[model samples]
Target: MTNLQDRYGRRFEYLRLSITDVCNFKCQYCLPDGYLGDKHQHFLSVDELRRVMHAFAALGTSKIRLTGGEPSVRKEFEQLIEIAANTPGISTVATTTNGYRLAANAHKWRQLGLSQINVSLDSLDPELFRRITGNGRHQKVLDGIEAALDAEYRKVKINVVLMKDLNHQQLPAFLEYVRQRPVDIRFIELMQTGLGKDYFDAHHISGESIKQQLVALGWQVQPRGPQDGPALMLRHPDYAGGIGLIMPYSKDFCASCNRLRVSALGKLHLCLFTECGVELRDLLGNDQHQEMLQQRLLAQLQQKDATHQLHQGLTGVTQHLASIGG
Candidate 1:
C-alpha cells in the first residue's frame, strides 16, 4: 500500500511540482521590474522530475499539478507532462499557467492526459493587464483560454486575483465572462509573499466581501467540497460552473491542507506560509545522501502543519513569490 498518511495524519495524496523557475511574463505581483537573477540556477531535469514523481507515487500521490515561473516555457514541457501522465497511480495531471503560451500547446497537453488548467487573468482591460503582468500579453492569454476551452481541457479554472483599487471593478464583468463561457471562475485573494514584501502591498479582499457582492448580483453562494489549499468553492443558483474563493489570509486552513509544494529547484515546502524548506535537489545529487534524505522527507511530512501561521498576524515574508510558482 502507498504510504499515503504522514506523521500528522495528513494524506500525501496531492503533489505540486514546479518544472522550471523561469517565466516569460514579468507579472507585477510575481516579480518586480528590473528584477535580476544573474547567477540563479533552475532545478530538476525531466528525468529527475520523473524520479521525484515516482517516489511520491509510492506514497499514494495520484494528483499532481505542474507549475513554474510559467511551466510552458520549460523546454519540452509537453514531454514532462507525458512522463507524469504515464507515471503509475498519477491519475490527475494539471497545470497552473499564465495562459500566454498555452494556445500554441493546448492540443499537445490535452492529448497527454492533462486534466486541468488554471489560468491567471487579473483584468479584462489590456492596459490593466499589462500593468498587472509586466509582459502584457492579455490577448494571447485570452486566446489561449479560448483554445483550451475548445480543446476540452477537463477543467479550465480562471484565476482572477482581486486587489483593491486595481481590478476590483472588473468582478462583475469577469463573473459575466465565466457565466457564458462554462469555465470555473475562481477569485483569489492576494497573498503575502516575496511579491507582497518586495514588489507590492497586500491588497485586502475577503471571501465574505466576495460572497456579499455575489448576493447583491442576484447570485447565491453555496460552498462545495472543501478544498485543500486556499480556495473555497461556491455556486450560483443556476450557473453550470462554480465560483471558488482562495483565502490565504482570511482563513488558515492547515487541517485539511493536503498539498505539498516542490519548488523549481527541488525544495519541498510543506506549507505556503513556512520559511523552512528541504533542499531535495542538492540532496539528490550525492549518492551517499539518499538514505538520510529519504528518511527526512518522511519525517517532515509527519511534521507538516495542518494549516499555515500566515493568518496569525501578517508576519513579514521573505521568500519571493516567484520562487514558489504561485
Candidate 2:
C-alpha cells in the first residue's frame, strides 16, 4: 500500500474528517458567538464520505477520526461511523465530540463500530463548565463520559483546552478525576484563531508549565504510537488513566505530525492553520475519480509547510476551530 508521505518525511496514517460544521455549543475559545454560519450548508454526503474513506484507506490510512463543530450533531453520524469502521484497510473509526448525545448514544455508537471516542470537557466544575461552554449541561456531559466508559470503548479521551484563569488551576482536580478511571485526559494549549486573538492573548498558557508540574508529580512520559496525534502522553503508577499535553506552540511540535484534516465541505487542509485549502469536492463527485482524487491528495503533500505559521500570530484562514473541526 502507498503511504501518504510529505516532503519532510512525515507519513500520515490518520485522517480527521469533519462531517458537519454545525455545533450547538458556544465554547469560549471556539464559537464564542455561537454558530453563525449557514446551518443548511451542504456538508459531505454519506456516499461522498464513503469514497473519501476508501481512497484514504487504500493509501494506507489506518485510522479515520470524525470531527466537527460537534460531530455527533449530524443525523447520519452513526452511519458515517459504521462506514468508516467497515472500510477496507481502516482499522480504527474514532470521533471527537462535545458529549452532547454521548450519554444516550455511546453504547449504540460502539455497537455501530466506533472504536475510540474523545469528549471535550473543558472543566470539572459545573459552573465553570457552563461558563466556558455557555451552556448548563455540565452534569449531562459528565454522565455521557461515564456512559462512554461503560460502553467498553477501545479508548476514551477527554480534551481540555487549557486557559490561564479558566481551568488551568484545576489540574489537581483533573488528575484526581482520572486517578481511578481508565481515561486519557488531554490538556491542549489554547491556540490563536483569527477571531479569538484577544481572548487567546488573555488566556493562552504554555503547556510546558503543566508538563513541568506533571513531571514533578512523578508522571512518566510515554512513547507515542505511529498514528497518535500531537499529544505528549504521560502516565503515573498511582492513576489508572493517562495525561496528554497538546502544545501546538511548543518547539518541534510539527516534527511528529502524522495526521491530515478534511473539512465538511471536502477541502483538504495540510495544516489546521493553513492559509488556504485544496478543494477536493470535485474529485469526490463519483467513484470514477478515485484515481484522480488519490493523485491530487498525493501531489498536495509537496505543498504542505513544514510547520504552521501560528507562532507568528498568523491563524491563516481558520477563524475558528468549528469552521474545520479543531
Choose the strongest candidate by TM-score. 2
The residue-level lDDT of candidate 2 at 259 comes to 89
Candidate 2 C-alpha lDDT tens digits along 186-210: 9999999999999999999999999
- How close is every model to the real structure, measured as TM-score? 0.90, 0.98
Judging by lDDT against the true structure, name the best candidate. 2
Task: Please give, for residues 1-326, the per-residue lDDT of candidate 1 as tens digits.
Answer: 34656666656678889887677777666665633544457567776787678767766778889997778877768888899899998988999998978889888789988988999998999999988888668889999999998999889989887787788888777877877687888888776664465333546666578877777877765544433445676667656677887767665455556778888778888766666777787666644654555566677787765566666544333345557666
Off by over 4 Å in 1: 38-40, 198-202, 223-229, 282-294, 312-318
Q: Each prediction's Cα lDDT score?
A: 0.75, 0.93
| Model 2 poorest 10 in a row by lDDT | 222-231
Of candidate 1, the 10-residue stretch with the lowest lDDT total is 312-321
